[model samples]
Target chain A: MSTRELKHAGLNLQQTDPKTHEEAESRVFGFWVFLMSDAVLFALLFATYGVMLSGTAGGPGTQNVYEMKSAFIETLLLLSSSFTFGMASLAMKYEGKASRISVWLAVTLILGLGFLGMEMHDFVKMIGEGATPERSGFLSSFFALVSTHGLHVLGGSIWIVVMLVQLSVFGVTPAVKTRILRLGLFWHFLDIIWVGIFTIVYLQGLTP
Target chain B: MNQEDRAEYRRELRSYIIGLIAALVLTAASFATVHWRLFSAPTGILIAIYLLALVQIIAHFRYFLHIDLRKSARDDLQLILFSTMIVLLMVGGTLIVLFNLKSRMF
Candidate 1:
């Protein structure tokens, strides 16, 4: 297929040789499927959180525990990380030097770590205030949903580090290229989930 | 990279920039709507917030995920839509049944 014809979901795979390109195409598609299933998992968690919103059992509720400023900052961090990951993908595709890709990925990793730190801080403050997950169903579900997303960010950060090492060792082979593309999808996907969390958990919590 | 590749790089870069700007705007607006009490009622604020979030999600899907209605991208789109449907069914049913039972018991 021509380059134009090879242009499809996730990332463009046409930069590789034909054999590797074909392999990467299916692999990226499979990753997309995995992402969708993961979406369903998050959706269920969201639903559970929604159901338990009223079950605070006299513990700290949304307004009492959530700080909008912190959540907003976290949102900014994750969103910027998503954009940075996009730049990494671009560097992978267009730039000859692997250093460019590594730079972008490093920036993204920092942003991801920043997000995790802020979220953990929020959790720490909430728990310090006696809003532990064991305190109520609401807090339990809230922790479950938000922490799952946080763990995903943590996992993505580790993947970013691994990809950095792979880039040094493999030097942007078709395999490494496809892996980075999949990483981009995962990173961006986490940002999308954060959008949901800030909207439903944070914004909705502060609505009243 | 060659000139054409550089041009393509700029194009993709533009998409990411656009996505970032759109997401920032949406997120800021959502927070501002609540912080400033833009809407007098809680329901109004919730609706406005959710609508903005929906738009931002679509923006992420388009620019970040590279999902569109193009023929080449349709398969992934279809999978996402299908997953969304299943999610709605499962989550919606859970809510409906649980809330119904809660009302009956209490």
Candidate 2:
């Protein structure tokens, strides 16, 4: 009759032990594992950085034109978006209000879009400034590494829009719930990678 | 879960937020030195910032991730350690190969 007694009884049914929320929690665990794997991809890039840093040749080095202020703005935008995503996930889980969850997701999507747009703009400006990948080995690797990340963010934003559409038409069925659960891990994982970029590429690029 | 456990989770969440913010601030400060030169060699400063940034990233994994180092159970810790080792081998191995090729080629 009591809560403890109920839980103990619930445990007897292994299949029914975990509620939908409990199922969702395990997805988070799986996502963490995925992030660890993705970290390896980044580690490869970092190693590349270590190797090719001095390969910049006599061409324009990082500071010859990496606008620190612009980089800062981009960093702030991405970091703030990460917080917005946290808010969205929390709203979805705790509030269980469909409309509000969508609203938070929309807000998160907008911020995410803004971050990627700025990055794209930055890439164009860099190229226009004659800092294209063909200029040097360093530039080639920089473009490859940084642009891959931007593309990932772009992909994630598109996925968000698709999920929003799903939530409205189908409502939060078990499938939709599980998808959101996995996406939460993914969105946060990207944010973690962004933090790495903001530090290694954006911050370090300004030095010297 | 019990009230005590929920409260502990909340505390953990707060600590993660604090740590993340501090990392962000230090990260920004490290590079915001564009207006002034704290170090003479750009290469040295760049490497220093990169190393620091890596530390900040691992900090996020530890706190926000809840991947406890103390794995009284086999599943979580074993998975994490195995994955980490594999990743390290791949990345470190790639670095050696690529850099050597880079040295020889161009």
Q: Each predicted complex: what DockQ?
A: 0.80, 0.34
In terms of lDDT, the poorest run of 10 residues in model 2 chain A is A6-15
CAPRI quality of model 1: high
DockQ score of candidate 1? Answer: 0.80
List model 2 lDDT by residue over A1-208, tens digit each. Answer: 2222221101112223347545544655676577677767776776676567777888978777577777777777766665565555555544445687688788879988888888888889988989888998788878878887888888889988988999899875656756765675577667778777766766666655
Q: Model 1 over residues A1-208: C-alpha lDDT tens digits?
A: 6334555533455555677777787888899999999999999999999899999898888999989999999999999999998888877776646899999999999999999999989999899999999999999999999999999999999999999999999897878888899999999999999999999999999877
Q: lDDT (CA) for every model shown?
A: 0.89, 0.66
TM-score of chain A of 1: 0.95
**Clash pairs (backbone) in predicted model 2:** A208-B42
Q: What is the lDDT of residue A147 in candidate 1?
A: 96
What tens digits encode model 2's per-residue C-alpha lDDT throughout B87-106?
Answer: 77887788788778877997
- Considering only chain B, report the TM-score of each candidate against the true chain B: 0.94, 0.65
